[model samples]
Target: MKILKRPAGLILLLLAALSFQSQDGVAGSNLLFYGLAALALIIFFYIVVSVADNFMVIESKQIGVKDTGSMGLFPSFREIFRPKKPEYLEKAHVYTLTKGYDIPMAGEPREEIREPKVTRFALTPPDFFGLMPIPKMLVEEGDTVKAGDPIFFDKKLNRIKFATPVSGEVIAINRGLKRSIAEVVILADNEQQSRDYTLPAATASREELVEFLLESGAWPAIRQRPYNVVADPDVVPRDIFISTFDTSPLGPDLKLTVRGRMDVFQAGIDVVRRLTNGLVYLGLDGRGEDPSPFEAINGAEKRYFRGAHPAGNVGVQIHHIHPCGAGENTVWTLGVEEVLLIGELFKNGRYDTTRLVALTGSSFSDPCYVKTYAGANIAELLSGAGEDIAENARVISGDVLSGTQKSTDGFVGFFDNQITAIPEGNEAEMFGWLLPLKPRASISPTIPVLSDDIEITTNTHGEKRAFVVNNDYEQVMPMDIYLTQLMKSILVNDLESMEGLGIYELVPEDVALAEFACVSKQPLQQILRQGHDTMIEQG
Candidate 1:
């Protein structure tokens, strides 16, 4: 027997011996004891074998996409439990957004203005922790742009444009104080926008393809973590990871989405392969019945994971399989559709612009799909979809648990194409927590009594606090990195300790759930981002 299996077998033998000794007194018969012992041993071995099979330590022997470094997501529980150095805190850059009424964290709730419907558009600058200096306007109020035209291009010619995601004339431009670009309003150009156009296929090198992607707005979908910067398509990543699973509420169905888009995804994989000499690994949901699209691709490797929310996360996946290191500088991750665009760009010369966004949530009148360009307006996308929504409701670009709260007037997130609309209901319960949770309520370990096996509705039936639980560590986290310790390190500005704790393996979204679940209302992402910035600055 192999070294590891031998111990397990020994354990079984010991268990059998114990069973034999225990049964020695039964019926004053050694024959009865032997039979019972045999049964007990069989049962014990069955359970042990099942557990080992489920928690198998899969090694990466070949150099396909699945060669995980020390930085990826699949370390064993023993390895994960090993002690590591601690991180310290540092001064952070904090940007506060408009907060009106405070849903009391502990005491009296603070009051603020209540609008019938809050519609505002706020854009985060493209660079990490960047402040937008009077954004240079590329389109005048009266100019007409084709579906795929540049509206704002940076000095490097990395353009940010609007394709009339819903073809429309520029009806209004809402500029804030000192002519800060607030929102660009368009009157839906029905005929022009309604026409569906597909890209014509063509082949190009990785560098040329990246430029084409930037020109077409597809590069925004490929987001890099650590710095939370969008990947510079011009540069090669050490490896590429494709995630076919999301555990967030109302998350996209990768299997359904990837269906029929395999060719485009293949093209995208081909392009990504060109950029990295390292392996490409595709992460599949362990719960999934079907093989992942990456398995269909020639060079990619596949890993299947089973567990709770963060288990399916790409950050966690990367950490388990292959960890990032100094020489293995950068690793890239993307969703299934984003990969299709890569293939679409090479197979067809044009950029695959419109993203397939799922419109789902309790606030939505109907759950559906919308074909919209990147950075399109949420108002336009939610126009007809909010038919059943309550008067006072919240609409977010991503899942309510982890997604940023965007104003109704805000544009869709550059990367998140999903639309999540949920009701901000008015019924105030006398004691909300005391009441029995409905089957629809979404709760994890902190809430307790939330049965693990039950399939509940995607909506968060619980109240939304700025933060309500101190779940910064193991509860919501499924990664190997010690989040609480890492956050402390970032706060105290401990770079070396942070590195030792695998800080480079994390991004804002990796900790977004912690923020959402925090009872203290701590800004988890901000802290993580700040820690990352401090590390970069120190370097």
Candidate 2:
């Protein structure tokens, strides 16, 4: 029994068990003898595995891995049979998400960043969630304002300021349903004007840094979790998360967005680090062996994730890294572009929200990156591309799967970096559901997917139906939460069960793929958002 821990001893024990043929040359109780032999082999195999784990630790240390615990060659047998984590979730910071659905859409942007003269831009209050129906306007119609000048402030949270993206005259303050401020349109100046803020010190107090961000109209860049709203100024977040890449269909290569802007990115990270009491985590693209630009970014912790769409979602990254829980366990997330904007704000003391917007989808004549401000006019952007955008084409402010729909006159979303234009599915294809012959995007075997880049239109094909229980949600959604159950809870307004089912770990984009994969054609994102509102209202 004492010799069971050693490989040599296990081998001898195995030999003894296998060689002990009951002395009667294997009698009628051969089943027990066979069991004894199997047990010995299993023990020996576990011992060999223990030795391998020990060797791996030693080898890791030899290569200067200081934190690899226990370098003992003949390690304990328990190491082999220890209940390990499931393959989907590894113990390390690096993750290889196995379950997710990649949407193939055409046309993808070429490896070119186009600098178009986007003259018109707007700041729509509705673009941001959790803001009041109407924010108190700082500048009105025909008011001349600089880039960093305050446009409006939330009535409840007066400290957080929303700034204009460019130096321009406020041409219109469009009102929507119920006199709510729809958009504050600006006729941008050719030679842009900007406000020069005082850059705070690297070792500045949290109050000083927060004050600078608030005053510079960059506070909206730091959004809180659970509600996915603009974080309050008084509360320091538990942690901050940033995804260095995007995996949504026709998503911009974020690396390109921040190209030659590493210094600014690092400075932005420094400011972000001071915003949170805990660590600032960066979720990097781990599919490639090459190091990301943010790998060298200082003052923040780095984590790697490799998988399909939504893997690059900061919410997913947050869920895996340090999931948001109940109470004041608040967290915040920012995009790579937002980080660069923050960096620029602090580095140069200017509020520059320059966007490298990816114009993708089959509707455009040239699908490529366009450099513009945050809320550049869609019509100007499309016309600048020298492509006559079809009046019927459905333009989106972001990716096709989860982006906000927009018209030619619509402005780009504040949080969006990519603009997608796809063909509208106004006229349904005859027998399209019965025989899905078109080379389109679908995880289901029904639609013949020939490549990862298929032309997808805005058609659902099928209407919403009874929620059928199947493996659909699990196949596409890699999170540990049961989406089917969670969606049901949301549908019924069961807040208690929603929290228990990991609702805090989700945002609308996190379940966009799951919604796409649902056979019922459920409006999952809408449902989830409603649930979030319910939770907030109850609280």
Task: Report the poorest 10 consecutive residues by lDDT, candidate 2.
Answer: 83-92
Q: Cα miss at 90, model 2 (Å)?
A: 14
Please provide, for model 1 over 1-539, each residue's C-alpha lDDT reduced to its tens digit, 9 standing for 90 to 100. Answer: 23234345566666556655665565546655676777677667766764554344243324332323222333444445643311210121111111111111111111211111212222333321222434456667666654444455444333532223334456566677777555555554444423233443345555665565666645655756556456655557788888777766666665555567777777788777766778888876654444444456676876665555666678877776776644347787777777876666567655445466666665555566655555566775566334344466777777665666677767776557566766554556456556644432323434544333232233333543442324445556666567777777887887888889878888777777666555555677888878877876776
The clash tally of candidate 1 reads 49
Which candidate tops TM-score?
Answer: 2
Worst 10 residues of 1 by lDDT: 100-109
Task: Report the lDDT tens digits of candidate 2 across residue range 1-539.
Answer: 45555666666665556556554454636755665777778777776766687789879756755334435555455545544443433443566576797787778889887777887899989878999989999987889999989999999989988999999899999999999999999999999878977777767899998888888898898788887888878887888888999999888898888888999999889788887779999998876656666778888888888777778888888776678865678888898888989889878878899988888888888888888889999988878867566557898898888899988889999989888888898876778887776776778875667777677888888899989999998998878899999999999988899999988888899999999988899999999999899998998
Model 1 CA deviation exceeding 4 Å by range: 1-136, 155-205, 214-217, 325-327, 425-472, 536-539
Residue 25 of model 2 has an lDDT of 58
